[model samples]
Target chain A: DVKVTQSSRYLVKRTGEKVFLECVQDMDHENMFWYRQDPGLGLRLIYFSYDVKMKEKGDIPEGYSVSREKKERFSLILESASTNQTSMYLCASSLKGYEQYFGPGTRLTVT
Target chain B: DQQVKQNSPSLSVQEGRISILNCDYTNSMFDYFLWYKKYPAEGPTFLISISSIKDKNEDGRFTVFLNKSAKHLSLHIVPSQPGDSAVYFCAASDRSGGGADGLTFGKGTHLIIQP
Candidate 1:
């Protein structure tokens, strides 16, 4: 079974603070994605990487960026965290044209 | 604009009954559909999937039915148990994009099973 692990299960940060969320997948899948889930609105893609050092902006990528220094690891960075950024963040990995396996989400609280 | 929609925000059914969750997509380009179940504080888990080429796909007590003409799909869970209670999200992908593009998801429907 594919295992995707996140660095933190819960986090709290003050406004304007920079935050980094880490994710690692054991399956060595080529595709990695970051998404945020909010009430009323479902999970919205934030960023995705198809290869190491390659990233694409998803529907909601503002204030967020990503890095893929290694094939098994992907990171999400928030340049300046705001109160509105508080939400559940999910990391997922998938092979080309296959179903994605998601990691235990990180619930972030930006106060 | 929302490409995918789940009209029902929540559904309540007695345990051991059938739970039906519906989904609709506005994009005709979407050819692959999937259903995911999410428990509180946990990431959504892949449940079942159906391709445009088929109308139905079954796994265990969960089955997905797709209607290409209507651009809609439904997931049916028979003999639903308490463990079946969770948020169900319907997602679609344009396979022609070669899977690099992430899936478009609906708002999700919360299913509650009452014993």
Candidate 2:
């Protein structure tokens, strides 16, 4: 089966600490996305990479960044974890912007 | 502003009944719509999708209906099972904006199935 996997299912971080959430897809899709899923706000895209080393800011890219060193892997980085940044982080991959396959998600708790 | 809207935050239905979840969109440029089901602590999974060219699409017990004129679409689940209970998010995409696109999602409707 096609699969998207994340490095962590849950993470706890202290304020001001740098954080990295990793995702990988075996499908060799060119498009990879990072989104923060929050109550009442739904899934807001933080950043996406259509190709390796190419990234674009999404609707809510503030305080976040992403890296796509390889086509099969995309990473979301929080420069500094804050209490308000605590939320579910999702990673997804798609071929040519079509139906996306998502990872299980990493729930981050920044305290 | 939310381009895709799921006004209902929650819905409850009994087992063996039909569960209707509604969504509306404001962007006329949107040509593709999709429904995703998410359980707690898990990522949302693609459920069904409908393109602007079609009005209805069905897969097994789930169906998606699109009304382009009204800018509305809905997902129907027949004989709602407990396993079917989850958060449903409506999303849309417009390729006109350029680049490989990302989806605009609604707040999500939490569906509850009771026996």
Candidate 3:
């Protein structure tokens, strides 16, 4: 079975602190994505990478950036965490014309 | 604007009964529609999908129906089991650009299976 792993399952950080969320996929998928999910608002895309060293801004890219240094790993970075940035973050990977496989989400809370 | 919308936030059905979850979209350009089931504290799992060219797709007990003219779709589960209690999300995409872009998702509906 394909596996997608996230570095952290739960995290708490102080306001203004820098945060890193890591995602790794073993399927050699060509597409990786980061999304933040909130109650009533659903999942909103933050960023995505289609290839190594390439990234694109999604609908809600503010305060977040991504790095895809390798084909198997993608990282989401929060330059400066804020209270409003706390949410459940999800990582997903997919190949062309295939369904995306997701990692167990990381729930982040900024105090 | 929410391109995909799941108007019902929650639904309850008895075991061995039918459960129907509805979803609507505003974008006519969306040609692919999918449903995902998520358990608490877990990531959403792919359920079933239907393309705009076809109106219905079925996998075992799960059936997905699409109405292109109205931009509406639904997931029907027959003889719903207790394990089926989870949140369901509806997603849509155009996929015309080739590469896996992003999928617009609905808010999701929480389904409760009663015994």
Candidate 4:
């Protein structure tokens, strides 16, 4: 089965602090994505990577960035955590023209 | 503007009843559509998908129908069970980048199945 793992399930950070959320997929899929889920807003894409060292901005990439140094690993970085940035983060991996598999997700709170 | 829209915020259905969730998209570029189910704290999981070339696709108890002309799609769950209670999100993709562009998602509908 396809397994996607995130570094943390829950995290708390202070405002202005930098935070990193990591995700790794065992299936070796070519595409990795990061999304944030908010109440009433559903899930909004933050960033995505199609290959190692390649990245693309999604609909809501303003306060976030992503890094994919290895094919199986993708990381999402928050330059400076803000109250608005506190939300559930999800990671997904998918092959070309296939459905994506998702990680358990990380709920981050910025105080 | 919201490219995808799930007008209903929630729906309640009794066990063994058919539950239908509807979605609409305004973007003509969306050629592929998908449905995802999400629980409380877990991430959303892929449920079903339909390409623009097909009008309907089914898997077990779940079926998805797509109408290109109306830019609408719906997911139907037959004999809804307790496990079917969750948030359902409708997503669409243009496939212009071969899935690398990601997908646009709707606000989601919370489904509740009563026994």
Tell me the tens digit of each residue's lDDT in model 3 across A34-54.
998999898888998889998
Q: CAPRI band of model 1? A: medium
* Model 4 stretches astray by more than 4 angstroms: none
| Correct interface contacts retained, every candidate | 0.60, 0.70, 0.58, 0.79
The sequence of per-residue lDDT tens digits that candidate 4 reaches over residues B48-90 is 9999999999999999999899989999999799999999999
How well is each residue in A1-110 modelled by candidate 1, as lDDT tens digits? 99999999999999999999999999979999999999989999999988999999999999999999999999999999999999999999998777888999999999
Q: Give stretches of model 2 more than 4 Å off.
A: none
Q: What's each prediction's TM-score?
A: 0.98, 0.98, 0.98, 0.98
Between 1 and 4, whose lDDT is larger?
Answer: 1
lDDT to native, each model: 0.94, 0.93, 0.93, 0.94
TM-score of chain B of 4: 0.97
Candidate whose lDDT is highest:
1
Q: Considering summed lDDT, which 10 consecutive residues are worst modelled in model 4 chain A?
A: A93-102
Off by over 4 Å in 1: none
For model 2, how many clashes?
Answer: 0
The weakest ten consecutive residues by lDDT in model 2 chain B span: B94-103
Best by DockQ: 2
Q: Between 2 and 4, whose DockQ is larger?
A: 2
What's the ranking of the predictions by DockQ, best on top?
2, 4, 3, 1
Estimate, for each residue in B11-61, the C-alpha lDDT of model 2 and write its tens digit.
999999999999999999999999999999999999999989999999999
Tens-place lDDT per residue, model 2, A1-111, is 669999999999999999999999999899999999988899998999889999999998999989999999999999998999999999999987488889999999999
What candidate 1 keeps of the native contacts, as a fraction, is 0.60
